[model samples]
Target: MSDAGDKVARIRELNDNFRKTFAGGMMMMTASVAALPEMVRSAAWLKVSEFDAWDTGNDPHHEHDFINFELCNRNFFWKCDYYAPDMNSGSEDPSDPEKTVRVGLLMLAEDY
Candidate 1:
């Protein structure tokens, strides 16, 4: 094969590896949430992000942006929203003023 063909093959291999790793992480996250619904909910209230597979990367400037996860299970999907409590004018009670919240949402894919 040519050099370009070899490079393409390597890239495809890397992409496959990344996909598998990410999928495994998502499965683990789903299991964890299923096992500890209350804990997850409490953490959400506290704005404690970074669940097993998901991280919001909580940047203040991109609070409205979302890190999306499209799981293999077509029924479900996940997303982590970087939220700035202080910046939001709609809310009377915000969780944290200085730090952004990594709000994780797991919902039906159809609903999303």
Candidate 2:
């Protein structure tokens, strides 16, 4: 392959690796906290005030750094806005007794 072609291939590989590493870490963290139901439940209400796990802007992304997106229920991973209604918001009211909360994987982007 030409130099340009090789570079493109490497970039693609890096992107794939970035996505996988972020997803895996999120899953593991979720699993580890599985034993604590209350903690998991609390995670729902807790907004990610500060998180920079992935450096999406950087070219040479490492295993510990990449780009990611987080959703309230993983049902809306594509949605970037946090103000959007979550899946639970549709089924039951947060103030009601039938509340069902789920932890979402919010992607940590860099600050401008």
Highest-scoring model, lDDT: 1
Please provide the root mean square deviation of candidate 1 (C-alpha atoms, Å).
14.4
| TM-score on alpha carbons, each prediction | 0.29, 0.24
> Could you give candidate 1's per-residue lDDT for residues 52-96 as a string of tens digits?
333446323223223333333334445443345553533232222
lDDT at 35 for candidate 2?
38
Backbone clash pairs for candidate 2 read 54-66, 69-107, 70-105, 70-106, 70-107
Off by over 4 Å in 2: 23-112
Best by TM-score: 1
Scored by lDDT, model 1 comes in at 0.37
Q: CA shift at 2, candidate 1, in angstroms? A: 33
Residue 71 C-alpha lDDT in model 1: 35
For candidate 1, the clash count comes to: 0
